[model samples]
Target: MAWFMGAVLLLALLTALLAPRLLRLQQERQERRADEHYRKQLQAATDHAITTAVRARLAEPVVDLHITIPMRVTVGDVIARALEDFALEVPWDHAAAMLRHRLEFRGHARWPDLITDVFDDEEDHTP
Candidate 1:
């Protein structure tokens, strides 16, 4: 009887030592999955925004126009980099028009200002 009780005590001690590590590993795995999901969502949003903008520009006749607009991405840095990359292939006028369309599609009249306002808030900002 005493031996049985001792074995039970040992098992309990081992379980207590191992449980936290197992829980932590599970938590880390969940977090990793969440991050991957978020990245996918961001990429999808970016692609959609760009496509919308291009379509909008194509809807109009090609003509020279000076328009300084923001990219569809919610982050200024990302928008700047995307604009730079896009400018390599697309003419400035077309690119600007597309960006404007994308911003409108995203329900923001001005993408840069809207994005800045969104991130500047101290509250829980999830878009």
Candidate 2:
């Protein structure tokens, strides 16, 4: 019985020593999967023009405007650039609402300020 308990104790010690490394490997695997999924989504969204992006102050979207996404650019950055370019003609509220519908944004979005500047502090408050 004492030997059995000793073996269990040894196993527990080994597990404690190796657990952090195992956890790190698992986390790295998850991150890789997430990155691959994000890349696929970006690839699929490419070659597609943002049709409804009205300028921040303009009544209509830019005429004959199209952006062919570069291979290296992230999707969020592309959207940010589009918003920045259109900031002068499009209304703030419209741009903000449009952003949510146009792409699947995750984590820290690149340029929230473009729309935030349009609304007052209370109006732009997001949880």
The best candidate in terms of TM-score: 1
C-alpha TM-scores of all predictions: 0.45, 0.39
lDDT of 2 by residue, 12-126 (tens): 9999999999999999999999767644443333213232222222444455557322222233433454445433233334444444444334222243322322223426434
Global CA lDDT of candidate 1, please? 0.51
Tens digit per residue, CA lDDT, model 1, 14-91? 999999999999999999997676445444444555555545545766455664343233333334444454432333
Instruction: List all candidate RMSDs to the true structure.
Output: 12.5, 12.7
- Kindly report which residue stretches of model 2 are placed more than 4 angstroms away from their true locations once superposed: 47-127
Candidate 1: worst-modelled 10 consecutive residues by lDDT: 113-122
Question: How big is the positional error of residue 69 in model 1, measured in Å on the Cα after superposition?
Answer: 14
